[model samples]
Target: MRKLASICLVFLIYFACSVMSAEDRTIYQFTVKDSDGADVSLEKYRGKVVLIVNVASACGLTDSNYKQLKELLDTYHERGLEIAAFPCNQFGGQEPGCDADIKNFIADKYKFDPDLYSKINVNGADAAPLYQFLKKEQGGTLIDAIKWNFTKFLVNREGRVVERFAPTTAPKDIVKYIEKLL
Candidate 1:
Protein backbone atom coordinates (compact mmCIF):
# COMPACT_ATOMS: atom_id res chain seq x y z
CA MET A 1 0.00 0.00 0.00
CA ARG A 2 1.00 3.67 -0.24
CA LYS A 3 1.52 3.97 3.52
CA LEU A 4 3.76 0.89 3.59
CA ALA A 5 5.86 2.26 0.72
CA SER A 6 6.32 5.59 2.53
CA ILE A 7 7.42 3.89 5.73
CA CYS A 8 9.93 1.75 3.82
CA LEU A 9 11.37 4.85 2.13
CA VAL A 10 11.75 6.56 5.52
CA PHE A 11 13.57 3.58 6.95
CA LEU A 12 15.88 3.46 3.97
CA ILE A 13 16.75 7.11 4.37
CA TYR A 14 17.43 6.64 8.07
CA PHE A 15 19.73 3.70 7.41
CA ALA A 16 21.64 5.59 4.74
CA CYS A 17 22.12 8.61 6.97
CA SER A 18 23.35 6.51 9.85
CA VAL A 19 25.93 4.86 7.61
CA MET A 20 27.14 8.22 6.32
CA SER A 21 27.43 9.66 9.82
CA ALA A 22 29.45 6.72 11.04
CA GLU A 23 31.86 7.16 8.17
CA ASP A 24 32.25 10.88 8.76
CA ARG A 25 32.60 10.82 12.54
CA THR A 26 35.86 12.29 13.88
CA ILE A 27 37.25 13.93 16.99
CA TYR A 28 36.16 17.30 15.65
CA GLN A 29 32.57 16.30 16.18
CA PHE A 30 32.94 16.36 19.96
CA THR A 31 32.56 19.32 22.30
CA VAL A 32 33.80 18.97 25.86
CA LYS A 33 33.72 21.31 28.85
CA ASP A 34 36.96 22.85 30.05
CA SER A 35 38.05 23.17 33.68
CA ASP A 36 36.11 26.42 33.90
CA GLY A 37 32.94 24.71 32.60
CA ALA A 38 32.99 26.34 29.18
CA ASP A 39 32.25 24.09 26.25
CA VAL A 40 35.21 23.69 23.92
CA SER A 41 34.81 22.22 20.49
CA LEU A 42 37.49 19.83 19.39
CA GLU A 43 37.12 21.38 15.95
CA LYS A 44 39.38 24.19 17.12
CA TYR A 45 42.28 21.74 17.12
CA ARG A 46 41.70 20.72 13.54
CA GLY A 47 44.83 20.70 11.38
CA LYS A 48 46.94 20.13 14.49
CA VAL A 49 48.48 17.00 15.92
CA VAL A 50 46.74 16.50 19.26
CA LEU A 51 47.76 14.41 22.22
CA ILE A 52 44.61 13.76 24.25
CA VAL A 53 45.52 12.49 27.70
CA ASN A 54 43.37 11.40 30.64
CA VAL A 55 45.26 12.83 33.61
CA ALA A 56 45.15 12.40 37.37
CA SER A 57 46.59 14.57 40.13
CA ALA A 58 47.46 11.83 42.64
CA CYS A 59 48.53 9.06 40.29
CA GLY A 60 52.06 7.68 40.55
CA LEU A 61 52.71 8.55 36.90
CA THR A 62 51.75 12.18 37.45
CA ASP A 63 55.21 13.61 38.08
CA SER A 64 57.18 12.16 35.19
CA ASN A 65 54.31 12.38 32.75
CA TYR A 66 53.48 15.96 33.55
CA LYS A 67 57.13 16.94 33.43
CA GLN A 68 57.59 15.35 30.03
CA LEU A 69 54.28 16.74 28.82
CA LYS A 70 55.46 20.22 29.73
CA GLU A 71 58.66 19.67 27.80
CA LEU A 72 56.74 18.41 24.78
CA LEU A 73 54.31 21.31 24.88
CA ASP A 74 57.12 23.81 25.16
CA THR A 75 59.02 22.25 22.32
CA TYR A 76 56.24 21.59 19.81
CA HIS A 77 53.23 23.71 20.67
CA GLU A 78 54.18 26.25 18.05
CA ARG A 79 54.67 23.47 15.54
CA GLY A 80 50.96 22.52 15.57
CA LEU A 81 51.15 20.10 18.46
CA GLU A 82 48.42 20.43 21.09
CA ILE A 83 48.13 18.50 24.32
CA ALA A 84 44.56 18.28 25.64
CA ALA A 85 44.52 17.00 29.21
CA PHE A 86 41.28 15.61 30.61
CA PRO A 87 41.19 14.94 34.33
CA CYS A 88 39.66 11.57 35.21
CA ASN A 89 39.07 10.09 38.65
CA GLN A 90 38.11 6.64 37.46
CA PHE A 91 41.38 5.16 38.59
CA GLY A 92 42.00 4.63 42.30
CA GLY A 93 40.32 7.94 43.20
CA GLN A 94 43.55 9.59 42.16
CA GLU A 95 42.00 12.75 40.77
CA PRO A 96 39.68 13.42 43.70
CA GLY A 97 39.24 17.19 43.76
CA CYS A 98 37.33 20.02 42.26
CA ASP A 99 38.48 21.51 38.95
CA ALA A 100 40.08 24.44 40.73
CA ASP A 101 41.93 22.20 43.11
CA ILE A 102 43.23 20.03 40.27
CA LYS A 103 44.38 23.11 38.38
CA ASN A 104 46.17 24.43 41.41
CA PHE A 105 47.79 21.09 42.06
CA ILE A 106 49.14 20.92 38.54
CA ALA A 107 50.51 24.44 38.74
CA ASP A 108 52.16 23.91 42.10
CA LYS A 109 53.60 20.48 41.46
CA TYR A 110 54.40 20.48 37.75
CA LYS A 111 54.87 24.19 37.16
CA PHE A 112 53.08 23.62 33.87
CA ASP A 113 49.88 24.86 32.36
CA PRO A 114 48.01 22.46 30.12
CA ASP A 115 44.80 22.66 28.12
CA LEU A 116 42.94 21.12 31.00
CA TYR A 117 39.40 19.83 30.50
CA SER A 118 36.75 19.09 33.09
CA LYS A 119 36.95 15.97 35.21
CA ILE A 120 35.27 13.04 33.45
CA ASN A 121 34.87 9.30 33.76
CA VAL A 122 36.97 7.50 31.18
CA ASN A 123 35.45 4.07 31.66
CA GLY A 124 32.19 2.38 32.71
CA ALA A 125 28.62 3.35 31.83
CA ASP A 126 29.14 7.04 32.46
CA ALA A 127 32.22 7.50 30.31
CA ALA A 128 32.24 10.69 28.30
CA PRO A 129 31.18 10.35 24.69
CA LEU A 130 34.48 11.83 23.54
CA TYR A 131 36.35 9.09 25.38
CA GLN A 132 33.99 6.51 23.90
CA PHE A 133 34.79 7.72 20.39
CA LEU A 134 38.52 7.68 21.03
CA LYS A 135 38.34 4.17 22.47
CA LYS A 136 36.38 2.95 19.48
CA GLU A 137 38.92 4.45 17.13
CA GLN A 138 41.98 2.96 18.81
CA GLY A 139 41.19 0.57 21.65
CA GLY A 140 44.80 -0.70 21.94
CA THR A 141 45.62 -4.10 23.41
CA LEU A 142 43.12 -3.92 26.25
CA ILE A 143 40.21 -3.24 23.92
CA ASP A 144 37.62 -0.49 24.59
CA ALA A 145 38.13 -0.25 28.34
CA ILE A 146 40.76 2.26 29.39
CA LYS A 147 43.27 0.53 31.60
CA TRP A 148 44.33 3.40 33.81
CA ASN A 149 44.79 7.11 34.12
CA PHE A 150 47.32 8.90 31.89
CA THR A 151 46.18 6.75 28.97
CA LYS A 152 46.79 8.90 25.92
CA PHE A 153 45.20 9.05 22.50
CA LEU A 154 47.17 10.58 19.67
CA VAL A 155 45.04 12.25 17.03
CA ASN A 156 46.48 13.22 13.69
CA ARG A 157 45.79 16.48 11.86
CA GLU A 158 42.67 14.98 10.34
CA GLY A 159 41.19 14.25 13.79
CA ARG A 160 41.60 10.52 13.51
CA VAL A 161 42.68 8.61 16.59
CA VAL A 162 45.85 7.06 15.21
CA GLU A 163 47.55 5.75 18.31
CA ARG A 164 46.72 4.72 21.88
CA PHE A 165 49.48 4.74 24.46
CA ALA A 166 49.42 3.00 27.80
CA PRO A 167 49.56 4.81 31.15
CA THR A 168 53.23 3.97 31.54
CA THR A 169 54.26 5.30 28.14
CA ALA A 170 56.21 8.46 28.82
CA PRO A 171 55.26 11.60 27.00
CA LYS A 172 58.83 11.88 25.74
CA ASP A 173 58.49 8.50 24.13
CA ILE A 174 55.78 9.88 21.83
CA VAL A 175 57.78 12.68 20.26
CA LYS A 176 58.81 10.64 17.24
CA TYR A 177 55.19 9.95 16.37
CA ILE A 178 54.25 13.58 16.80
CA GLU A 179 57.12 14.68 14.59
CA LYS A 180 55.96 12.34 11.85
CA LEU A 181 52.47 13.79 12.00
CA LEU A 182 53.70 17.36 12.10
Candidate 2:
Protein backbone atom coordinates (compact mmCIF):
# COMPACT_ATOMS: atom_id res chain seq x y z
CA MET A 1 0.00 0.00 0.00
CA ARG A 2 2.90 2.41 0.80
CA LYS A 3 4.53 1.82 -2.58
CA LEU A 4 1.25 2.35 -4.44
CA ALA A 5 0.64 5.65 -2.64
CA SER A 6 4.16 6.83 -3.51
CA ILE A 7 3.62 6.07 -7.19
CA CYS A 8 0.33 7.94 -7.16
CA LEU A 9 1.96 10.96 -5.57
CA VAL A 10 4.68 10.98 -8.23
CA PHE A 11 2.13 10.80 -11.01
CA LEU A 12 0.18 13.67 -9.50
CA ILE A 13 3.30 15.78 -9.30
CA TYR A 14 4.15 15.16 -12.94
CA PHE A 15 0.64 15.97 -14.06
CA ALA A 16 0.62 19.20 -12.07
CA CYS A 17 3.88 20.35 -13.57
CA SER A 18 2.68 19.75 -17.10
CA VAL A 19 -0.53 21.65 -16.45
CA MET A 20 1.40 24.57 -14.98
CA SER A 21 3.28 25.05 -18.20
CA ALA A 22 0.15 26.49 -19.80
CA GLU A 23 -0.04 23.31 -21.82
CA ASP A 24 3.32 24.17 -23.35
CA ARG A 25 2.47 27.60 -24.64
CA THR A 26 3.68 27.86 -28.21
CA ILE A 27 3.21 30.68 -30.73
CA TYR A 28 1.37 28.20 -32.94
CA GLN A 29 -1.30 27.80 -30.30
CA PHE A 30 -2.76 31.28 -30.82
CA THR A 31 -5.06 32.81 -33.39
CA VAL A 32 -5.18 36.61 -33.50
CA LYS A 33 -7.07 39.17 -35.53
CA ASP A 34 -5.35 41.05 -38.31
CA SER A 35 -5.80 44.69 -39.31
CA ASP A 36 -8.85 43.62 -41.26
CA GLY A 37 -10.29 41.89 -38.21
CA ALA A 38 -9.85 38.51 -39.87
CA ASP A 39 -8.88 35.53 -37.75
CA VAL A 40 -5.29 34.57 -38.48
CA SER A 41 -3.74 31.49 -36.98
CA LEU A 42 -0.21 31.83 -35.77
CA GLU A 43 0.27 28.22 -36.91
CA LYS A 44 0.92 29.64 -40.36
CA TYR A 45 4.16 31.12 -39.04
CA ARG A 46 5.43 27.84 -37.68
CA GLY A 47 9.03 27.02 -38.68
CA LYS A 48 9.88 30.67 -39.19
CA VAL A 49 11.81 33.01 -36.93
CA VAL A 50 9.18 35.53 -35.80
CA LEU A 51 9.70 38.96 -34.32
CA ILE A 52 6.60 40.02 -32.45
CA VAL A 53 6.40 43.73 -31.70
CA ASN A 54 3.81 45.87 -29.98
CA VAL A 55 3.77 48.87 -32.27
CA ALA A 56 2.29 52.38 -32.21
CA SER A 57 1.96 54.98 -34.93
CA ALA A 58 2.50 58.08 -32.80
CA CYS A 59 5.22 56.94 -30.44
CA GLY A 60 8.52 58.78 -30.29
CA LEU A 61 10.33 55.62 -31.33
CA THR A 62 8.08 55.05 -34.31
CA ASP A 63 10.26 56.53 -37.03
CA SER A 64 13.50 54.69 -36.34
CA ASN A 65 11.84 51.45 -35.38
CA TYR A 66 9.71 51.38 -38.48
CA LYS A 67 12.60 52.17 -40.80
CA GLN A 68 14.92 49.63 -39.25
CA LEU A 69 12.22 47.01 -39.04
CA LYS A 70 11.59 47.46 -42.73
CA GLU A 71 15.29 47.05 -43.38
CA LEU A 72 15.41 43.83 -41.38
CA LEU A 73 12.39 42.44 -43.18
CA ASP A 74 13.74 43.37 -46.57
CA THR A 75 17.06 41.77 -45.74
CA TYR A 76 16.02 38.48 -44.15
CA HIS A 77 12.49 37.74 -45.37
CA GLU A 78 13.60 35.08 -47.80
CA ARG A 79 15.71 33.53 -45.04
CA GLY A 80 12.64 32.84 -42.84
CA LEU A 81 12.34 36.03 -40.78
CA GLU A 82 8.75 37.08 -40.21
CA ILE A 83 7.75 40.24 -38.38
CA ALA A 84 4.35 40.25 -36.73
CA ALA A 85 3.47 43.82 -35.77
CA PHE A 86 0.69 44.26 -33.23
CA PRO A 87 -0.50 47.81 -32.75
CA CYS A 88 -1.27 48.65 -29.15
CA ASN A 89 -2.42 51.90 -27.62
CA GLN A 90 -1.68 51.02 -24.04
CA PHE A 91 1.11 53.53 -23.73
CA GLY A 92 0.15 57.19 -23.67
CA GLY A 93 -2.59 56.40 -26.17
CA GLN A 94 -0.11 56.59 -28.98
CA GLU A 95 -1.94 54.38 -31.41
CA PRO A 96 -5.33 56.09 -31.51
CA GLY A 97 -6.34 55.49 -35.11
CA CYS A 98 -8.51 52.77 -36.55
CA ASP A 99 -6.95 49.88 -38.47
CA ALA A 100 -7.17 51.47 -41.87
CA ASP A 101 -5.73 54.77 -40.68
CA ILE A 102 -2.84 53.02 -38.98
CA LYS A 103 -2.04 50.97 -42.07
CA ASN A 104 -2.17 53.96 -44.34
CA PHE A 105 -0.03 55.99 -41.95
CA ILE A 106 2.72 53.41 -41.91
CA ALA A 107 2.76 52.82 -45.61
CA ASP A 108 2.43 56.43 -46.72
CA LYS A 109 4.68 58.01 -44.13
CA TYR A 110 7.22 55.30 -43.41
CA LYS A 111 7.09 53.75 -46.83
CA PHE A 112 6.82 50.34 -45.16
CA ASP A 113 4.13 47.75 -45.09
CA PRO A 114 3.99 45.24 -42.26
CA ASP A 115 1.92 42.25 -41.28
CA LEU A 116 -0.35 44.46 -39.22
CA TYR A 117 -2.62 42.99 -36.59
CA SER A 118 -5.67 44.50 -34.95
CA LYS A 119 -5.01 47.06 -32.24
CA ILE A 120 -4.70 45.36 -28.87
CA ASN A 121 -3.99 46.21 -25.27
CA VAL A 122 -0.54 44.91 -24.49
CA ASN A 123 -0.82 45.34 -20.75
CA GLY A 124 -3.38 45.34 -17.95
CA ALA A 125 -6.57 43.31 -17.53
CA ASP A 126 -7.60 43.42 -21.19
CA ALA A 127 -4.30 42.28 -22.62
CA ALA A 128 -4.40 39.99 -25.61
CA PRO A 129 -3.90 36.31 -24.87
CA LEU A 130 -0.79 36.15 -27.08
CA TYR A 131 0.70 39.11 -25.19
CA GLN A 132 -0.14 37.43 -21.92
CA PHE A 133 1.68 34.31 -23.03
CA LEU A 134 4.61 36.34 -24.25
CA LYS A 135 4.91 38.24 -20.97
CA LYS A 136 4.73 34.96 -19.11
CA GLU A 137 7.47 33.49 -21.28
CA GLN A 138 9.78 36.50 -21.07
CA GLY A 139 9.02 39.30 -18.68
CA GLY A 140 11.11 42.28 -19.67
CA THR A 141 13.93 44.09 -17.80
CA LEU A 142 12.04 45.22 -14.72
CA ILE A 143 8.40 44.31 -15.21
CA ASP A 144 6.34 41.99 -17.34
CA ALA A 145 4.30 45.00 -18.41
CA ILE A 146 5.45 46.50 -21.66
CA LYS A 147 6.93 49.94 -20.96
CA TRP A 148 6.24 51.59 -24.29
CA ASN A 149 5.66 51.10 -27.95
CA PHE A 150 7.83 48.71 -29.98
CA THR A 151 8.59 46.17 -27.28
CA LYS A 152 9.73 43.10 -29.21
CA PHE A 153 9.68 39.40 -28.56
CA LEU A 154 11.83 37.02 -30.56
CA VAL A 155 10.49 33.57 -31.25
CA ASN A 156 12.47 30.87 -32.92
CA ARG A 157 11.31 28.58 -35.70
CA GLU A 158 10.19 26.06 -33.11
CA GLY A 159 7.56 28.53 -31.80
CA ARG A 160 9.50 29.26 -28.62
CA VAL A 161 9.86 32.78 -27.26
CA VAL A 162 13.63 33.01 -26.97
CA GLU A 163 14.22 36.65 -26.08
CA ARG A 164 12.46 39.86 -25.13
CA PHE A 165 13.59 43.31 -26.12
CA ALA A 166 12.65 46.58 -24.52
CA PRO A 167 10.81 49.18 -26.57
CA THR A 168 14.02 51.13 -26.90
CA THR A 169 15.96 48.26 -28.44
CA ALA A 170 16.49 49.12 -32.05
CA PRO A 171 15.43 46.70 -34.73
CA LYS A 172 18.97 46.84 -36.15
CA ASP A 173 20.38 45.70 -32.80
CA ILE A 174 18.35 42.52 -33.05
CA VAL A 175 19.77 41.43 -36.41
CA LYS A 176 22.46 39.26 -34.87
CA TYR A 177 19.94 37.35 -32.81
CA ILE A 178 17.71 36.79 -35.83
CA GLU A 179 20.69 35.67 -37.91
CA LYS A 180 21.68 33.16 -35.26
CA LEU A 181 18.18 31.72 -35.12
CA LEU A 182 17.77 31.64 -38.88
Candidate 3:
Protein backbone atom coordinates (compact mmCIF):
# COMPACT_ATOMS: atom_id res chain seq x y z
CA MET A 1 0.00 0.00 0.00
CA ARG A 2 1.08 3.61 -0.54
CA LYS A 3 0.96 4.37 3.20
CA LEU A 4 3.14 1.36 4.02
CA ALA A 5 5.72 2.40 1.40
CA SER A 6 5.91 5.91 2.85
CA ILE A 7 6.51 4.58 6.38
CA CYS A 8 9.32 2.31 5.22
CA LEU A 9 10.99 5.15 3.38
CA VAL A 10 10.88 7.35 6.45
CA PHE A 11 12.38 4.61 8.62
CA LEU A 12 15.19 4.01 6.14
CA ILE A 13 16.17 7.67 6.05
CA TYR A 14 16.16 8.02 9.81
CA PHE A 15 18.28 4.92 10.32
CA ALA A 16 20.89 6.02 7.80
CA CYS A 17 21.51 9.45 9.31
CA SER A 18 21.08 8.86 13.03
CA VAL A 19 24.77 9.69 13.53
CA MET A 20 27.67 10.75 11.42
CA SER A 21 29.87 8.03 9.96
CA ALA A 22 32.67 7.07 12.33
CA GLU A 23 35.12 6.50 9.51
CA ASP A 24 37.10 9.51 8.23
CA ARG A 25 35.88 11.42 11.25
CA THR A 26 38.22 12.93 13.84
CA ILE A 27 37.45 14.17 17.34
CA TYR A 28 38.79 17.58 16.32
CA GLN A 29 35.76 18.10 14.13
CA PHE A 30 33.50 18.67 17.09
CA THR A 31 33.08 21.60 19.50
CA VAL A 32 31.97 21.03 23.09
CA LYS A 33 31.02 23.27 26.00
CA ASP A 34 33.35 23.67 28.97
CA SER A 35 32.09 23.93 32.56
CA ASP A 36 31.70 27.68 32.16
CA GLY A 37 29.50 27.13 29.09
CA ALA A 38 32.19 28.36 26.73
CA ASP A 39 32.59 26.55 23.43
CA VAL A 40 35.88 24.69 23.18
CA SER A 41 36.95 22.98 20.01
CA LEU A 42 38.79 19.67 20.13
CA GLU A 43 41.00 20.94 17.31
CA LYS A 44 43.34 22.64 19.76
CA TYR A 45 44.45 19.21 20.91
CA ARG A 46 45.27 18.08 17.43
CA GLY A 47 48.90 17.24 18.02
CA LYS A 48 48.43 15.90 21.55
CA VAL A 49 47.45 12.47 22.75
CA VAL A 50 44.09 12.89 24.46
CA LEU A 51 42.04 10.78 26.84
CA ILE A 52 38.33 11.56 26.84
CA VAL A 53 36.33 10.19 29.75
CA ASN A 54 32.80 10.42 31.13
CA VAL A 55 32.99 11.07 34.87
CA ALA A 56 30.55 10.96 37.79
CA SER A 57 31.28 12.61 41.13
CA ALA A 58 29.42 10.10 43.34
CA CYS A 59 30.36 6.86 41.59
CA GLY A 60 32.27 4.18 43.49
CA LEU A 61 35.16 4.41 41.06
CA THR A 62 35.40 8.17 41.43
CA ASP A 63 38.26 8.31 43.88
CA SER A 64 40.57 5.87 42.17
CA ASN A 65 39.81 7.13 38.69
CA TYR A 66 40.36 10.79 39.51
CA LYS A 67 43.52 10.07 41.47
CA GLN A 68 44.96 7.96 38.70
CA LEU A 69 43.92 10.45 36.04
CA LYS A 70 45.57 13.28 37.93
CA GLU A 71 48.68 11.19 38.26
CA LEU A 72 48.69 10.49 34.56
CA LEU A 73 48.32 14.18 33.83
CA ASP A 74 51.10 15.17 36.15
CA THR A 75 53.37 12.59 34.52
CA TYR A 76 52.56 13.10 30.88
CA HIS A 77 50.79 16.41 30.45
CA GLU A 78 54.06 18.05 29.50
CA ARG A 79 54.73 15.15 27.15
CA GLY A 80 51.70 15.97 25.02
CA LEU A 81 48.96 14.27 27.00
CA GLU A 82 45.56 15.89 27.49
CA ILE A 83 42.57 14.73 29.48
CA ALA A 84 39.03 15.76 28.64
CA ALA A 85 36.70 14.68 31.39
CA PHE A 86 33.00 15.01 30.72
CA PRO A 87 30.80 14.93 33.81
CA CYS A 88 27.82 12.73 33.08
CA ASN A 89 24.86 11.95 35.35
CA GLN A 90 23.30 9.14 33.36
CA PHE A 91 24.64 6.37 35.56
CA GLY A 92 22.59 6.12 38.78
CA GLY A 93 22.43 9.92 39.03
CA GLN A 94 25.88 10.11 40.52
CA GLU A 95 26.94 13.58 39.34
CA PRO A 96 23.97 15.48 40.76
CA GLY A 97 25.61 18.88 41.03
CA CYS A 98 25.97 22.03 38.99
CA ASP A 99 29.16 22.87 37.06
CA ALA A 100 30.53 25.06 39.85
CA ASP A 101 29.91 22.34 42.44
CA ILE A 102 31.51 19.68 40.29
CA LYS A 103 34.54 21.89 39.78
CA ASN A 104 34.80 22.61 43.48
CA PHE A 105 34.53 18.93 44.40
CA ILE A 106 37.37 17.86 42.10
CA ALA A 107 39.59 20.76 43.15
CA ASP A 108 39.04 20.22 46.85
CA LYS A 109 39.03 16.44 46.94
CA TYR A 110 41.65 15.56 44.33
CA LYS A 111 43.43 18.81 43.43
CA PHE A 112 42.40 18.29 39.84
CA ASP A 113 43.04 21.53 37.92
CA PRO A 114 42.01 20.69 34.38
CA ASP A 115 38.94 22.25 32.85
CA LEU A 116 35.72 20.51 33.80
CA TYR A 117 33.11 20.19 31.14
CA SER A 118 29.38 20.64 31.45
CA LYS A 119 27.40 17.54 32.38
CA ILE A 120 26.45 15.52 29.37
CA ASN A 121 24.56 12.31 28.55
CA VAL A 122 26.84 9.57 27.40
CA ASN A 123 24.00 7.29 26.25
CA GLY A 124 20.41 7.23 25.00
CA ALA A 125 18.71 9.56 22.49
CA ASP A 126 20.23 12.71 24.01
CA ALA A 127 23.86 11.58 23.82
CA ALA A 128 26.38 14.20 22.69
CA PRO A 129 27.56 14.07 19.10
CA LEU A 130 31.17 13.40 20.12
CA TYR A 131 29.97 10.50 22.29
CA GLN A 132 27.77 9.18 19.52
CA PHE A 133 30.79 9.18 17.22
CA LEU A 134 33.03 7.53 19.82
CA LYS A 135 30.52 4.72 20.51
CA LYS A 136 30.14 3.99 16.80
CA GLU A 137 33.90 3.86 16.29
CA GLN A 138 34.66 1.51 19.19
CA GLY A 139 31.58 -0.49 20.12
CA GLY A 140 31.26 -2.28 23.49
CA THR A 141 31.10 -5.99 24.38
CA LEU A 142 27.42 -6.45 23.53
CA ILE A 143 26.11 -3.02 22.60
CA ASP A 144 27.30 0.26 21.13
CA ALA A 145 25.78 2.27 23.98
CA ILE A 146 28.04 3.43 26.78
CA LYS A 147 27.89 1.07 29.75
CA TRP A 148 28.58 3.52 32.60
CA ASN A 149 30.48 6.54 33.85
CA PHE A 150 34.27 6.91 33.49
CA THR A 151 34.17 5.34 30.03
CA LYS A 152 37.44 6.48 28.43
CA PHE A 153 38.14 7.03 24.75
CA LEU A 154 41.74 7.69 23.81
CA VAL A 155 42.52 9.77 20.78
CA ASN A 156 45.80 9.78 18.92
CA ARG A 157 47.82 12.86 18.00
CA GLU A 158 46.05 12.86 14.66
CA GLY A 159 42.73 13.38 16.44
CA ARG A 160 41.31 9.93 15.65
CA VAL A 161 39.96 7.72 18.41
CA VAL A 162 42.40 4.87 18.90
CA GLU A 163 41.07 3.03 21.95
CA ARG A 164 37.98 2.77 24.14
CA PHE A 165 38.27 1.93 27.85
CA ALA A 166 35.40 0.76 30.01
CA PRO A 167 34.11 2.51 33.10
CA THR A 168 35.89 -0.10 35.20
CA THR A 169 39.29 0.37 33.52
CA ALA A 170 41.43 2.76 35.49
CA PRO A 171 43.36 5.49 33.71
CA LYS A 172 46.65 4.08 35.02
CA ASP A 173 46.06 0.86 33.15
CA ILE A 174 46.33 2.57 29.74
CA VAL A 175 49.59 4.48 30.16
CA LYS A 176 51.34 2.22 27.70
CA TYR A 177 48.89 3.02 24.92
CA ILE A 178 49.26 6.72 25.62
CA GLU A 179 53.02 6.53 25.74
CA LYS A 180 53.00 4.70 22.46
CA LEU A 181 50.83 7.34 20.87
CA LEU A 182 52.99 10.13 22.21
**lDDT tens per residue, model 1, 91-113:** 99999999999999998988888
For model 2, the local distance difference test gives 0.92
Compute the lDDT of residue 33 as modeled in candidate 3: 97
Tell me the TM-score of each prediction against the true structure.
Answer: 0.91, 0.88, 0.87
Model 3 is weakest, by summed lDDT over 10 consecutive residues, at 16-25
lDDT of each residue in 1-182, candidate 3, tens digit only: 99999999999999876665755589888999999899999888989999999998999999999999999999999999999999999989999999989999999999997657899998889999999989987889889899988899999998888899998998889999999998
Q: What local lDDT score does residue 119 receive in model 3, on the 0 to 100 scale?
A: 90
lDDT tens string, model 2, 1-182? 99999999999999976786643678998999999999999998989999999999988999999999999999999999999999998888899999999999989998887789999998899999999999989997767898889999999988999999998899999999999999
Top candidate when judged by TM-score against the true structure: 1
Worst 10 residues of 1 by lDDT: 16-25
lDDT of 1 at 23: 45
lDDT of each: 0.92, 0.92, 0.91
Q: After best superposition, candidate 3 residue 173: deviation in angstroms?
A: 0.7
